[model samples]
Target: MFTGLVEDRGTVQLLEKNGSAIDLTLEISELITNDAHIGDSVAINGCCLTVVEINSGTLKFQAGAETLEKTNLGLLSQGDQVNIERPLAADGRLGGHFVQGHVDGVGSIKSIDRDGEWITMWFEVPEALSLQMVPKGSVTVDGISLTIVECQPATFSIALIPHTLEVTTLGQKQIGSVVNIETDILGKYVQKLIPLKLDGFNERQ
Candidate 1:
């Protein structure tokens, strides 16, 4: 799990092809490198990737075909920047929300408008996952946990505060960029369980 709180922005150093997998190398700040070990998981742009090697301020991980197909990571190159976060500790505070580091769908920046001290970002969501989203509900966009302010047929909007804008990659994001999105894990689970329970209730009825 992660908090969607970005620790630092890192650049992809290299991408090496190995059979059906691609080895990703990232060079992060020393602050994010402290105590991190090989086999540890780091969320890069919202995708949980295992650390295959850790040397200097750089780390390597392997990305399979499935992960590439599900996220915006495939669009990344050697110099692309991504939000990075270490896995949450067992006794740490839940600063953001429960982020599995699993990208559920891909979204595109549709519009960005400033509202006084904050900004309103509208993005397009796929129809299949739109059903699980609601006003005031939580959604993880590129691993940044945010609340849904509005939901449309194919898009949703979030109100971003100054701190959020300055601390994460969203600050530099522009329209037409693709982002990885993970819907609320709790909401998805409840949506699945409710229907099963309803069937049992109806059978009793």
Candidate 2:
């Protein structure tokens, strides 16, 4: 699992189609490269990808057909900046909420409201995914964990501090830009357990 905390931004070097999979290569800073190894999992734009190779200062990752269909990763081009984060270590501090690096849905920026140093971004969630959002809840957008400022039936907004804008891809986000979103893991579990609990109650009755 990941913590949704971006360690550094990596630049896409190449994207190649290899039959049923896409090979992604990224050039990252030494900080990530020194610790990176083949087979290690890294979260790139909220999608968990396995490192397949590390050669000449570039790390290679593979994305399958399912990932390409479900995430914004397929839209990546050479020179595009992607948020990168290593998986949370067993004893690492939990800087953000639990992020599985599994993109739950793709959301688009509906509007961007700037208030001096603070920017409030409103994203339109899919009808199927909107039910998971709640005001003040945690949501991972392109692998950056943020708190929801407001939640509507089909949309949610989050306030981004200047630091967040400077460090991550949110700085370049514009209206209509697609982003990977992962709703709160706890909320998903609760939703899943509710029906099971209700069924148990009916059986006891």
TM-score list, all predictions: 0.94, 0.96
Per-residue lDDT of model 1, residues 56-136, tens digit only = 989888999999889988788889888999989999999888999989979999999998879999999897677788999
lDDT of each: 0.90, 0.93
- Ten-residue stretch with the least lDDT total in model 1: 30-39
- CA lDDT, candidate 2, residue 150: 91
RMSD of each: 1.4, 1.1
List model 2 lDDT by residue over 1-205, tens digit each: 9998999999999999988789999999998999989899999998999999998778999999899888999899999999999999999999999999999979999999999999999999886677787888899999999999998888999999999999999999899999999999888888889999999999999
- The local distance difference test score of model 2 is 0.93
